[model samples]
Target: MLKRLWLILGPVFCAALLVALLLVFFPTKLRHDFEAEKRSAVTLTAASFKGRMQKVQALTDANHRFVPFFGSSEWLRFDSMHPSVLAEKYDRPYRPYLLGQRGAASLNQYFGMQQMLPELENQTVVYVVSPQWFTKTGYDASAFQQYFNSDQLTSFLTQQEGDAAAHHAAERLLQLYPNIAMADIVKKVADGTALSASEDQFVGLMARINKRQDIFFSSLIPSYNRHYDQRVLPELSRLPDEFSYQELEKVAIEEAKEHTKSNDLGIDDKFYKKRLKAKLRELKGAQKNLSYIKSPEYNDLQLVLNQFAKSKANVLFVIPPVNEKWMAYTGLREDMYQQTVEKIKYQLESQGFTNIADFSKDGGKPYFMQDTIHMGWLGWLEFDKVVDPFVSNPKPAPAYHLNSAFFSKEWANYDGDVKEFGNK
Candidate 1:
């Protein structure tokens, strides 16, 4: 009786263990769900940003045209005139897929691009270059670690040929997150050395494990942001049946006026009440000496340009401005800010990236900014004017001529009057 019972239970336990192991270790092949991708396209949550399935499917969808809107906290400023809302309300030819949130800077975007290289290839994309990201110290490591995508890291490390860009990226990754995950693999990659047979096998195994985890757990990712975007539907109803710039302008100014009345600073009422009301005075002249002229962020941005050139993506670069009142209160020097903008423009135009919508000098325009750094109702309208036409119609393909020197420390720290970049 004991032997018979043991035989039956042993097989059952063995079968259960096998199933569990397969569930955790086996790779999953995800299929396309176009309808589901509509929501995923607008879902700007970090989980969505870090994962590849949702983004790749939405980007490569045969039916819908989802253009990537890469920026930081500005994407979360969901007003009626926002690109997502305007596009949805107007029934435009393309939909904007937001890719960043607070704390997502240049380096964050560079690594995040690794997994979706195929999707980004030949894609028409927009990147909002924030002046604040050009701080002397550059990207904040703690913030970087919070949105870290291990899959992208694996892709970057394993596919590298010990090239200059790869070496720089690996070194930065190791330095940024001292206690970063997969330090052994990252350190080896940073050394610009070849991986051993066992290590190579281990990296591949980890990649599989990461993919398995993403597959089973992806459904649990939040859709709250997508839902939040749907609130624009009511606002969309308020628009005319036909598109009219005059009508939209009236709406934008009225909306901005109603929302920004609480502060003479042109900041949104709720934001001012919550974030600035307490320390309003203490922040005066706080940025008197703060500068954007020199930082390693320039090097990190080169990684993005390098990737785009390789992809041959037709790209649009947006330069956002600080609120004039806020800029004055903070005492940030205009000359210094202009120098940074000039440097940023030099980097882009020098690389043949010329489709730019520059609002860097429009900070003084009333109601253009929602707060200190983000675009409000009027600003988004101005953004739509340029962006809608670009994405709606076809254009000449990008003629990017990339320079590796932009990845060097000299360019990162160079404070010269950069009228032109040496595209050598």
Candidate 2:
């Protein structure tokens, strides 16, 4: 019986040993596909959002250029004129490597940048900042916890001096991650205390291990979202033989009309029927009391600016408008909405991060928003018009003069004119 058992387990043990030997000896034995990396440039899955290996690979690829499109659900809209589809259909000079999904706000995006600092250095990036993200309470803890990677925190803690951004990052992590795996280290940073020599050694060691682990396992995982796979490639067939804004907008309008026929709100039919049609009446005036003027997001946004400034990245910040009819139905104030836009613009311009595609006043235009607050139809076409030239052509690098004061609670709560950005 013992001999038979040894025979059964011996081969398995040897195989495991050989695999371990290969990992320790031939670390580079695992190969990756650049084609998959190309496909992943358009993949907007959560895994792709957090994984840095795929991003570094595509961003560094010599032949093709992939710009990082940092935003939330807007990227998933994937309408005929969406940035990704349009880029592929037109065979533009660059492809977009989308980096966020639902609930991925400034706080989530800031930390996600930590692990890819080297790749991001000097790269041009597009960030679509949504006004809807700014609320009275700021981002939800559960939501932040869901999209953030622990390795990202490890990378953050390893490089931080517990400065204002570091302090705020540590504090937010403390709140969102009550029992975080690295709570002890995070606590020290939050308290403005340095990690002990041993803690430093531990962090450095873990960083090495995490780096290797990420390299080893990332390829095993598919970077593509894998949703509507059948439709992703065939989408190219739907585009006009050549690029024409008038022709494309007509298609966009046609699509918007067909998808939004079931609702007066101009929201997609399936989304309306399943999500809003039943609650339509109750939603009226429900958003009247909500305010975007005061929130921690302003400070959270400062962290992103600080990162971009540090990296010297050429960036285009796209500020989108909400659906005006839906806003009126819900009694949301447009003046207040404009104030939010102005405040965000002030934060960007005051620091010399000046390239902006402000569509703040375009919400009232027909079919501009797919739903209450996301871009659609003519909105995307107009967006493409502005964005295409910016990315297609070269521009002078921005000179950022970052102010730590933006991270203060005062600025986070301030809702003043652009001229009085700090005076208020």
Query: Scored by CA lDDT, what does every candidate get?
Result: 0.82, 0.82
Model 1 misplaced stretches (Cα beyond 4 Å)? 1-31, 222-226, 420-424
Q: Write the per-residue lDDT of candidate 2 for residues 133-242, one digit (tens) a residue.
A: 99989989889888877678788988886788898888888888888878988989989997899999998877766666666667677645464354356667777987
The clash count for each model shown is: 0, 0
lDDT of 1 by residue, 1-424 (tens): 9899879898998998986686586656656665566567677778887787777767877777888888898987877888877887777888888889798988888888887888888888899999889889888888888888778777776666677778788889988888877887778777877889998888887776666666556756653444445655667766666888899888888888889888799899999999999999999999999999999999888888888888888889999999988999999998999889989989999889999999998999988999998997889989989988888885655788888888888899898867534632
In candidate 2, list every pair of residues with a backbone clash: none
lDDT of the structure predicted as candidate 2: 0.82
